[model samples]
Target: MMSEEKSALTQTERTFGRRQIQAGHALMMLISRAIPHPIGEVWAAVTDPDRLEQYVGRPEGDLRRGGTYELPDGTRGDILRCDPPRMLTLSVQRPGGHSAELELHLTAEDSRTRIDLKYASVRKGFVLIDAASGEWAAGPGWEFFLDSLSDFLNGENPEEPLGIIGWRTFEGEQLGLYQARNAEWEKVKADWDHEHEATPGPS
Candidate 1:
């Protein structure tokens, strides 16, 4: 089990991510982390169904490109692209007929594997309350999952289902970690907005 201080440090380090506006009203969120594992091991941990169930929910259905899959929690999505040991993209459907895109790209950084995740969603008046809060929700959500992935890679067994709020640590509930990460995302969005304001063009 990881100490509370160590877990907090891990969350802080993974909190750094970026938010950007894509074509028109679409928004893109990106987060990347380098795990101290080789590409093959990291790739397998993310793509293998049995391994995935350890941290993320167990996936059901064909995982290959163009196949549809459902998670144990009933979240369904279609695999848009799947390139072994490199990239995986999916179109995840949300409530109210809206959908989001998630893309994962992996690369070998020396002996470690760097995972880059991009999540994009089209802005619907009600779907996303606002850019800042929407990013606050999505950004830390991925950080929580990636942190779970790190825990799994380090041989720590997960005790409960993964989620953004009320995440558990060795000590107990660590909602503070989630809140801190949310703060980071808010800052990222603010910084991006400031930079765009200064430059005056689409970002």
Candidate 2:
């Protein structure tokens, strides 16, 4: 009887694990920072196309249900639903027959606002065969996208490809930042090399 119970537990765990992966590797994090502005101000920062372009990917949809969004290089998607200043649901359909759902939620806090972002991939293995796959992170794209969004909200440009391939290619300001960052890394590498030379290895 005990052995049977163990088997049942294992099966339950496996089921949960599979469900999580199907949800595109679940991740939840909270970021709290003073926006130095009101909730509506931050809301406008995200929903207004002209304002958003300053800090995020250019959007080309009406931002309503049954609307569409054109990403950089002409990649596009339809808006599944949206509730202004509160939530948005998007259906990002890729060329490789993979689609995903992006859920964005915003909540107002006194003098500040909190944004919750969630991404669920409706189609699995889309990255392995899609051209636009490079536009997102290998493991999950939500983190990278949110990081960029935060930086933009703070009035800063993203560091690289602006997405998944940011680390793969360097351009203009990206190249400059890359070079600077690598130069600092090289210094650390040299120090490590010197330390290694002074230490003894396994015999």
Best TM-score goes to which candidate?
A: 1
TM-scores of the candidates in the order shown:
0.76, 0.55
TM-score of 1: 0.76
Report the number of the highest-lDDT candidate: 1
TM-score of 2: 0.55
lDDT value, residue 51 of candidate 2? 65
Worst 10 residues of 1 by lDDT: 14-23
Query: For residues 96-198, could you state the per-residue lDDT of candidate 1 as single tens digits?
Result: 4556778889999899888988877774431212444343267777777788888898999677657322323322355566666666677777776676565
lDDT of each: 0.69, 0.50
Q: Write the per-residue lDDT of candidate 2 for residues 58-135, one digit (tens) a residue.
A: 678666677788765445677877778777767656555555656667788787676655555545432121345444
RMSD of 2: 16.0
Model 1: residue 11 alpha-carbon error in angstroms: 7.5
Q: Alpha carbon lDDT of residue 87, candidate 1?
A: 95
In candidate 1, position 68 carries an lDDT of 89
